[model samples]
Target: MPPQRPAPSARFTPPSRVRAAAFGLLGTVALVAFGLRIGDVAFVDEYAYISQSYYADLFLTGEWNDPAWLDFPGYDLMPLPKYLIGTALRVSNEPRPGPAAARMWYANTHSTFGTPRTLTSARVPSILVGGLGCLALAAIGAMAFDFRVGIAAGVLLMLNPLYALHAHRAMSEAPCEAFLMASLALALAAWRRSFAGRASGFRILGLLAGAGVAAALAVLAKFNGLLALMTIAAWAGLAWAIPRGAGWGWLWFATGSALAAVTAGLAFMALNPYMTARDPVYRVADPADAGPLRPGPLGAWGRFRLLIDHRRAMSAGQQRIFPHNALKRLPERAKVVAVQGFGRFGPFGPATSDSTIRYDMRQDRGAFAWLPLCLGAMGYAMAYGRMQSRRREPPAAWAVAAWALVSLTVVTLYLPMAWDRYLLPIQAPFSLLAAAAIVGAWDALARLAGWKPRLEPS
Candidate 1:
């Protein structure tokens, strides 16, 4: 009889040093999340959070009843982050009254840097959420690929100064990315379970529901999180295409998709009462009346329309101010995005601005050029592997490739300016790929050098 193969546990496992390295990396990510470059400078957009959060607290939680609550949040397509900003400012308020409530004070006019109390109120949530996002990214890397890959991705993202810059701001990008990564991690887990042949009805549905809910929250945070739709669609598509038991494939997929949609839809409607409004309601700032709000009844469709109209209006205003920003060349935009993907910007050609984040166009950059090198190595490995194996890799491999490359391409096609922060979503997935590439290159070099890898001996 043929010798029985060793059990799975007896085969391969990471060494203690790898575990130690991962923990160390995680510790470093946690440490840097709070202070590095945080409160460096006051951004022009920071003032909106002051007034918006004030109105949010007065309307969302306080007994104060006014139609202005609907209008105070923001003009952007999304509304959930207002609640987070509101809660942060409330914490600042409880610690004794001060200039934290002065709405116009933070408009990049009075101060060059963020003040103590206001910075805490406005940016703490983002800092914590962004730190947690690094954790989720690690999990995504592990689930989608391996533990080493996850750890590397997390470290790379943590080291990315651009991510650090925006993460410390009261912007929608960080939270949106966190939720989007969470959804991807959940979907990956579900895929692994199904691949292992243990996909029970309850297990699959629970995972799908969780993923869907995360996606909904992501979109609520930022329309950029709408990328979650691709993930959800991929799962639903897989359900229909990938074979289940003999004759139940169609029914199983249909049930899961419908159930997940229903559950997530309910959660979304609950989280964003903006969807429940009967007509279109939007906020307009009035310096004379200190930003009075006017809201109309709005339904779900109206909310979506609000997003489109607001984006269009923003585009028009931006074009007037930065006329050269609307570069119509796809190749030029793509080149700019690719460069920013690795945490470098300025186009700095020298880091300046007192090492503080003053302008989105120019700041700390050219730091992670090595990342793209790793990406190139990783791409070579992937291509070589594909050539050697006739079979395709998992669905995630294709999805991630599209996410990193295609998504960047799409974003660039419409990108109005060379803003580095807007590249966060694209950089996120690309970071994962680049981390894998780095590991692959190191292994390749080690092999070439005749260095043996550590293995558990029986």
Candidate 2:
């Protein structure tokens, strides 16, 4: 050097320091995850699940008939996850005398474990699953951006009250989220590697298997899980459509999709004995069972009568009354019931003293508002677009964004009931995108300013 510049001193933080920082960040995320679930009420459908665990045992052991077990229709709605939970209980030291035995044992053991047994015990799986969801989001972010983005995404997910509230509950939403997140992570990684021309056959197979398992698990968790699979299929199709890699990529994707469907079907049949029946007795009844239904005052009463009659007949196994005419009225009657039920109890305005209705409405409206989420989404889109235009986008960024968007759209649009629980699956990703937006915008603004970049000696 002409000026004999002084030797540059090493100013970089040591690898050990970096590792320590990461550990500290993870610890903070863990704290957030733990704190958010504290003091949450088992308010919405919590009892229904608790009751299902109790009754599932009864049905399995032949103590309860199909009709008795079917009284709570939600049990039949998603059978695999609940059944798996029940199986876990049986395998444990918990009593197996009958359907009620698990509940009894749970009651005695819950407090000892530092959580209430009823909803808490049932929620154990969900909590673990939610934690996994956080991890998946972090992986997605890291793979899509950098370690910093991953850690921030994980922290945001842990701190997000929407995710935490549902995670703490004994519901299927958390599990569904876990499966969906995991599937997306793996699929994105596989896609990235495939695009980079580094994916081996084994890697592709492993990724496909993981995706299949995750998608099947999601289906088992909730009917909405099917949306995840659909998203994957679309993503894979599009990825293959681009003249990028070997033709084998499309074959691999198709195989994975078929395997997922088969796994899901098998899991459903194995868990739900009812599916095997050629002619299941309790098929969703036709609208004609209710009679000729009109929307006016007299017609409404006629529809109500038809509904009552149908219920009575189903309960007593009698011939369906008003079969033909009632069928036409059923749709109108259902609409009326849904509207009345929601208006009377839904949280469109202020909270009420009626505990059940108040809680139900609050939970529904709180889940549906999406105001905070929408803000975060806007932030993510801006950041994502900028990264793409700048040619600084990570390999998996598009995949993760697509996956999140598809999952959110499916749940918000396809599902009939938009309960707060339905929003749980998207919460983790939403938090990630929100954090990315904030950090990316801040960095962009800093760059726009006259701030000089400094590089520490490595």
Candidate 3:
């Protein structure tokens, strides 16, 4: 070695390592913020918690087959959240009053509701899941783009008022977001591994299977779980189509995807027996009770059929809240999406204003709204520019853009009612996109200023 090449700066730290540290700190801050007042009494949507009590009581009594439990509104629509609550209650040996001769006696008798006196058991899972969502966002960003992008995305997500507020609440959205992001990240990672020349069959299978399980858990958390499958499919489709010629890799990926689907089905049925099992032994409601109840010695498929019908009815009923014409509704929907994405602009912003004065005042002025908006637009533009210039775009960008576009389109078309909470699925992708923008903009600025970048582009 040339003696003049004196010890190339051993003290210089890798940019990736620096970014990882920043991300870890951001995640920690998010965890603490989410955990704050987790067990505090919920003022709004208390009914959701109360509804969970019914399912928990049934599970505690070993009476999951009871059709009577199906009487609750939206019961057939989603059952995974409550099933999870039951598991948590049983494992912790919380004070469940069900299975006692009188149902709802202990719950109604005590103001705190049945099972755990503190709301900790009910709320902790959501808080933990919310924290996991933040990390998953980072992983997706890092794996798809770079470590710096991941860290920036995570910090932005934590700073989001709507996301942060809902994270600690005993609600399904937080957990849904967590499962959704985890599934997407795992699926993307699996595909990347498979594309590598040295990828092992076992490794690919494991990644695919893990993704399937996460997908199932996501669905259990909320009906929107199905969207994860769609996102992964779009990613795979884009990957295959963008390349010049079909390769053996496509066949392998498709086979793995089929296996993942089967695994997802098994996981879904295992966690939620009511969707498949015909065991009338646990009489959730009397079989004789009339109305739309279908008579049965039902098949495994019967529950799903009933669920479909119920969802259809619910959807039709919800149309009253939205404009009859989709065209007329598009502007309002777009406004909501923009406000939610970039954040509220000023004091008493329309998007941030709410019934709760304190909450409204705090959220009306969003944190670094313009910066994220500017960076995100630039990032996407750069991505497209690269593709146009004959550079193979990063697969992660395609995956994230597809997720955001598909999710936005579906919600705008099918979801008649407009509520901010309904848009939770977009949070991760939005944060990631913004982070991409920031990083992309920084690189452009560096190039313009003729400064050397420490970390080369991945």
Candidate 4:
């Protein structure tokens, strides 16, 4: 008889059913929470996007080459989310008049939060996208570590007030967060596949391409999302070329990444006609509602010109806000992250709720706030330090380090705002890193306290 195969090791193997159930539960929680008071407020920003969607409908109905009729001055607005909302409106057979259709589109889905009941439908897209963002967080964590870490990260992100607030609103941030995490997950997979072997050529190419596509969508959702793309490039660099590593594998990854970048550029152009259309109109006001419609030059170069013009407009807009000293602002930024993003303790005083929501932070000592943060710090330190000594370090570990580093640098150094919404991208990654530290500490403790049993005669 053939020798019995050695018992399968269960130490590192995770339960699939449990992971699925956790993900499902997390998704449900996200949907419910996001949907609860989503239409509570009709923010000024929402109107901008709704108007853009109306413009999209008109553009879609007009000539392909001369989208001259589709000039909405906020043409500088991110395209994917607006395009998606417009597509949804079209599918629902919204009427022709933009404002009338906009008003009628989100008619009758409201809870008691003082916003217009008709605006409820407008928030639906955000609700759905936000729920999906939770799942994306889970997927990213799991790809980097294990199922438990992923679930923990997802659940923590779901419960966080800052993420939830932006997610529930009909804004660009939710979609941007979702797409950013999706791209990060795909980038991780691409790195894994690219290094596995030449046998994974097609798989590697697909992953890289997918990452590129997702990154493009993220950027189209918000120009700030270019940070995720930068992170991806940085991670690839760290994985290859660094630590005395280089070969055909590195070449393949570089080639795939270059192609992926080109793909992303093409995707951006394809999605945003304002970026490529000739003689496109840049309307600041709805034509039906006493217009600010202005006709611009035509073609691809025209698109670039429009973008530059928009940038100047944005720069002018930014000038109105008072600037804060960066050094003095660091503490304020920390307080926001600790209280709103991470929820270190009871939500009051400095350790308090976010700008939009008044959520009670973790009251218990063992709650997600402190323990996970401490552990995450440990995990980060361990990963960063251990790699120097180890000849062959795990890619996942390094990726996590790189993610935290890149995200932290970008968030703290470049971005002047301390809003929790802007900090959403780092939440899931931090929680996962925390979970890693917790598990690592637990295992170390177990080994220290474990007992050995002597086998007599097997």
Instruction: Please list the C-alpha lDDT of all candidates, in the order they appear.
Output: 0.59, 0.52, 0.61, 0.61
- In the order shown, what is each candidate's alpha-carbon RMSD? 5.7, 12.0, 6.7, 7.1
Show the colliding residue pairs in model 1: 277-298, 278-297, 278-298, 279-297, 279-298
Off by over 4 Å in 4: 1-11, 15-18, 58-74, 90-117, 197-199, 242-247, 280-295, 298-316, 319-394, 445-458
TM-score for each model: 0.77, 0.62, 0.78, 0.75
The model with the greatest TM-score is: 3
- Tens digit of per-residue lDDT, candidate 1, span 1-458: 32223222211237769766776669466547655656566665655554455445544664233444354343443656666776777766633222233333434334322346666567777787778778888877665555677787887777665666667787777788888888777766665454333346567668768877987888778777767656556565654564333334334444565665676677776676555543333446455433234345565666558666777677667767666555456776666565554435321223222313322344335534544564674575355334322232233444455456545655786776656556667767777877767676676798899995664422
Q: Which ten residues in a row have the lowest lDDT in candidate 2?
A: 289-298
Off by over 4 Å in 1: 1-12, 15-28, 55-65, 72-74, 92-115, 235-264, 277-295, 339-396, 454-458
lDDT of 3 at 121: 69
- For model 4, give the 10-residue run with minimal summed lDDT: 2-11
- Which residue runs does candidate 2 get wrong by more than 4 Å? 1-28, 35-39, 54-77, 80-116, 241-251, 267-395, 449-458
Ordered list by lDDT, greatest first? 3, 4, 1, 2
CA lDDT for candidate 4: 0.61
Ranking according to TM-score, highest score first:
3, 1, 4, 2
